[model samples]
Target: RGGCMGQCWYTAVDTQLYLIAPLLIVPLHYFKDLGKAWLYIMTLTSLIIPGAITNRSLSDHERLYVNETYSTPWCRANSWIVGIWTGYIIFKTGNQLKLKKWQVVVGWTTAFATGWMVMLGMYNVNEHEATTTYIIYEACHRAAWAACLGWVAIACHNGYGGIVNGFLSHPVWQPVSRLTYGLYLISLEVQDDLVKYSRKNLFYFTTLNM
Candidate 1:
């Protein structure tokens, strides 16, 4: 359980971000363009700091250190800031996104492409030889992932999502969504305990098992 408590760190990080969200959100609400500029600056800063730290501390042969790059609040802020940006846009538009047909087509195309790029772009890469490339990915990938999700959210909210919206917004998901927090809290510990106390070897691994 002690080792499995790593999953719980996100709750603490999320709470810290929620505590400070008003600092960013209030200005964006009241100041318009100036606040947007601040957000853009903050977004860029968030992207840079993680890469800078990785480059400074990690050798060219080393992978990113999880504690520094993955678990830190500042390193994880890029996605949170992107979410805030998406929410701000939705608020301003009154949840009515009106784009031309061509624009909608292009937005969905680009969103899917970006999502795939983030998902598969690292495959078979030689990280030890291309540490700089890994550093750049480390800095940008979370924000890119968030931006893709943001597009999905925007499109679904405004009926541009077609079948995607139908699947995501289906009533069947409501009860499952309610259990996600409890699942998140206990699933890791259960898995850890099963492995720790098992008397026999676990079943063979496969994608299905995963």
Candidate 2:
């Protein structure tokens, strides 16, 4: 709620594990009956509950230190399907059905640009800003991202795009991507305060220091 990073992680939760974990597991084992564990994980992802038993004994309104978290498992399920499909399409296009060189360049660039547009479009906007529009835009955005990632993979497969792939494959992004989980864990707790404080004392911060 405080900073851009905090909000991004929340949205990422919805985009990634929320849909992803279930998609991955559902095909293998939970096809007939998705487990309670999946539901529980997605439920907590909304982060709306009062507090768990382990909560620091915080309370609100008429309830004890507990609150209700609400989410749509169906929506999450659909998103998971879409995410997987996007990846599938990219792979098929790049491998099974090859595109002409110029076409490859066009498709790759357009896909990449579209992905950035969606990602950046959602960055500053709070999740609660406009629920319906946000949801639709995000769905489109994520689909584009999947395609973008797939195209990059395709280019790598083609072998000549080594420079681009090499950059991405570099040790630099590796650590950040690998540490994403830890970053998510630590950043969320602190971002709320940091963002709030920064906004309150805007003059105190200079962009160069960031």
Best by lDDT: 1
> Candidate 2: where is the Cα deviation over 4 Å?
1-73, 77-79, 86-97, 120-139, 160-162, 201-210
Encode model 2's per-residue lDDT on 71-126: one tens digit a residue: 23332333344444445454446545555778877877786687778768767556
Ten residues in sequence with the least summed lDDT for candidate 2: 64-73
C-alpha lDDT of all candidate models, in order: 0.87, 0.51
Task: List, in order, the clash count of every candidate structure.
Answer: 0, 1
Off by over 4 Å in 1: 1-4, 60-64, 190-210
lDDT of residue 72 for candidate 2: 31
